[model samples]
Target: MDRAFRWAFIGTGTLAKKVAREITASERHVIATAYSRNREKLCAYCEPYNAYPAISIEDAIDRSDVDAVYINVTNESHYEVCRQALELGKHVLLEKPFTMNASDTEKLQNLAKSRGLYLAEAMWTWFADVPLQVRAFVQSGKLGRIREVYMSYCAYSIGYAPRVSDPLLGGGALLDIGIYPITYAYRLFGFPLSITCNGDIKNGIDYGEHIVLGYDGFDVKMDVSIVDTKGEAMIIEGENGFLANPGYHYGESAVAKTKSGVDIFKGQRSYLKEFDSVADEIRQGKTESSFIPPQATLDCMRILDECRRQMNLVYPFE
Candidate 1:
C-alpha cells in the first residue's frame, strides 16, 4: 500500500459528488473515473474532480487506474453494475438495499466471494461511528435480556425522484427509505422466527408499510412510509432497561436507560470515517468490511422481500 486507492464512480449524482469530495478532503483516496447515463452530465460532473469521464460502465470498471468502484446508481441498476464490476476483477462498494430483491443480492455476494474480491454495502449508518456505539451498548449485557425492539423511518418523497414512485425502476418506499429501520432490526435480532407485515400499494409500488417480526421471546415492531409516518425512535428494550437511537437511518447518537440511571451519547457523524475504513481494508488486501458485513446486507434484503410479499407489492423490473 504505497499509494492511494483510486475509485471509479458509476453514477454522477449528488451522493457521488459528496463521496468524492469526502474522499478527496480526507486524503485517503482519489477519484479516477466517472460514468453516467447522460454523457454530457458525466463530463460536466467530472470536471471539478479532474476524473476521467468514462465512455461506458464497462470502461469505468475496466480502468487500470481504478482500484475499486463506488456504485451510486439507481436501485434497479445496482445488481447489474455490481455484477459487472466484480466480473472485471475489481472491488465494489455498492449502494444500500444492495438490490431490488434478495435473490439478486445473494448472487452478487456469491460472485464477490468466488472472485476473492471486496464487496460491501454502502449503508452510511453501518459506517458511521455513532451506531457502533449503540451496538456496543446493546451487546454489553447492560440491557439485560432483550424484550422487544421498535423502529421507524418514514419520509415524504416529493418531486423529481424517479426511483421512488416508478414501478419499472424499482421505486418504492420500502426499498428507498424503509430499509433503514429494517436493517436496524435485523442487526439486533437477526432473521426472525416469523414475520407479519402489512403495507400500502399504489400502482405496483409501495407507499407505506408496518412489519412485526416475531422472535423467540420478543417482537420487533416497525413502520415506514413515503408520506408522513409515526415517530422516529429506534429502541431495543430489555428486561432491565433499553438501548435506543433517535432514528435508525440517520442515527446520530446512543441512549441508554436503566433503573439506576440514564446515559446519552451524541457523537460526531461524518462520511469520511467509513470511506477511510474501506481504503484501509483494500490496502490490506481484504474484500469485505468487518463493520458492514455481506451477510447482514443479504439478510436485510430478505426481510424486505418478505415485507414486499405481504404487501403484494410488485415492481415491473422484477
Candidate 2:
C-alpha cells in the first residue's frame, strides 16, 4: 500500500493556490496545512482544500501529520523555508530558482543527504512527460548532431509585481523567467564551453537577457526578457530536422520535423507529477527524487550564478 502523504505548504500565494488545486487531484498527496505571515489570508486560502491554516512556518512543519512540505514562496524565502523544513525531519519540494546561489543549494542538498531525507526542486519540466520525448528526439540520432539551436522565452510583463522587480527578493529576468531557456540549453547540451550574457537593467534588476552558450560542436542562442514580450518560444535546428516548441518552459507538447514528415509528440501531464514523485520516494524511504535530481538543481544554480556574474547581476541579500 502507498502512503497517502500529508503535505504542508509554507506560504500562501498564487503558487500555493495552484498547489492546492493540484494536490486534490493526486490520490497519494493531500495538503494537510498551510502557513502565511498573514494568518487570515492563509486560512481563507486553505479552507477550500480542507487544509489546516497555521499561523507561522514553525507551526506548519511541526504538524505530526505533515510528511513533507512544498515551499512555493518567493525566491528569497526558498532557502530558509527549505532549511527549516529539513531540520524538522520533513521532506521538501522547493519551487524553481532553488536558492539565491549554488552555495546555499549545495549546502541544503548536503544537509538532506546527511539526514537521510528527501529534497527536490520543484522544476516541473523534470517531472513532466514530454521532456523525456524531447530528450529522446535529441538523442535519437534522428536530428544527427544538432548543429545549431535557438531558444527564447520572452515574458514581457508590464507593471510587474514587487517581487518581480525587487533585488532584495532575488528578482530578475534570469532567475524568474530566464531559467527556462538556460534549462533548455542545458538539457540538450551540457554546460557550455563558453557563455556570453547581456541584459537590460533597471532599478537594480534585469528586465531582459540575451545569452549565447557556445558548445564544442554547436552554439545556442537564447534570449529571455521581461522587458520585451516578443518571441516566447524555442526552436532547435539540426542537420535533419528541427523542433518547434511554443512555451517550452512547461514542457508543452511540441512538434519535430524530419525529411519524411513532421512527427508530433503529444501527451499532457499535470503539475501533480512532482508531488507524486516526492510522495513515492518518501514512501520507499528514498533520500532523493530521481525525477528532479539534486545534481541537476546544482547545475542549474551554477549556470544562473555564472550568468549573473557575467551580467553583474547581484541581489542585495546575497
Candidate 3:
C-alpha cells in the first residue's frame, strides 16, 4: 500500500474531533499536526491520535511532512485559514458554508488554481453514493418529468449551540444548516433561475428561512431552522412517482417510489470516504474535486447570498 496521507488539522472543536477519529482510523490517512486557539484543547485533541500540536496555523501548514490541511474552524475564519493554507502550498479541505459568501469562495478557488494545490468544500453529501444514485435516477427519465422538490433541514441548534446564534462568528440558520438542502437542490437540478426567501431574524441572527429555488419547469422549496425541529426529509416529485431521502444531508440511503416498483440506494455514512477521496485526488495532482466542483460551491454560495439578501441578514463582520 502507498504511504498514509498526512494532514494538519486547523481546528480542534467538536466537529474537528469527530473528523479526527474517522480519518485517523483509516490506513490511508493520518493527522501530522493540529492547531487550535486553546493550547490545552489542541494538546488534548492531538494526544488521542498521537499527532503533533502546532503553535499556530502557519506552524501547522508550513511543515514539510504535512501534505494537506483539514480546516474545521469557525464559519467566519474559513476564507483566511483556507487562503493561508493554499498560499503555503498545502492542499485544503474546508468544512461547509464554504467561506461565508460566494466572493470569498471564488477567491479561494482561483488561488488554489493558480497555486496548483487541491481545494474542495468538504460537502460530504456530494461524495455519498445515495445522493449520486438519486441524481442518476432523476436524470434517467425513470422519475419522468420533475414536478417539484421539497427539502427541510430544520434543527434546534440555537439553544444548544451558542455559535449558531452568534452573528460575529457568521452564525445563522441559513449558513449553519440551510446549505444542505440548497446544495441538494443545486446538485440535482443545477443553478436556479430565481430564488425567493422569507425568514425570521432577531438579534442580527436568523432563526429560520423558507426558500424557493425556481428552475425551468419546477421549483424546489426548502425550509431551514436553527431554533426549532421540523422534519429533514427531501422529497422529489415527478410525473411517475416520488423519491424520499431522509436526513438528506448526511443520510446513507435514498428510496425511490414509482409505478413500476420501489428502488433503494444505500451507502456508508463515514468520513473515511470523504478523506480518502480527497487524498486520492491530491495524489493525482488535481487542483479541484470532481465530487464537489468549484462551480457547484460558488453557485450554492450565491444562492445563500441571495437568501440573506432577501431577508436582509448580514453577519457583523460583513
Worst 10 residues of 2 by lDDT: 153-162
Quick one: best TM-score, which candidate?
3
Q: Which candidate is the best by lDDT?
A: 3
Error of 1 at 185 (Å): 1.2
Give candidate 3's whole-model lDDT. Answer: 0.90
Model 3 deviation from the true structure expressed as Cα RMSD, one decimal place: 0.9
Models ranked on lDDT: 3, 1, 2
TM-score of each: 0.95, 0.95, 0.98
Clashing pairs in 3: none
lDDT of 2 by residue, 229-318 (tens): 686777888888888888677878889898768878776667777677778788888887787678878997898888899888877776
RMSD of each: 1.7, 1.5, 0.9
Write the number of the candidate with greater lDDT, choosing between 2 and 3: 3
After best superposition, candidate 2 residue 310: deviation in angstroms?
A: 1.1
Candidate 3: stretches off by over 4 Å: none
Best of the two (1, 3) by lDDT: 3
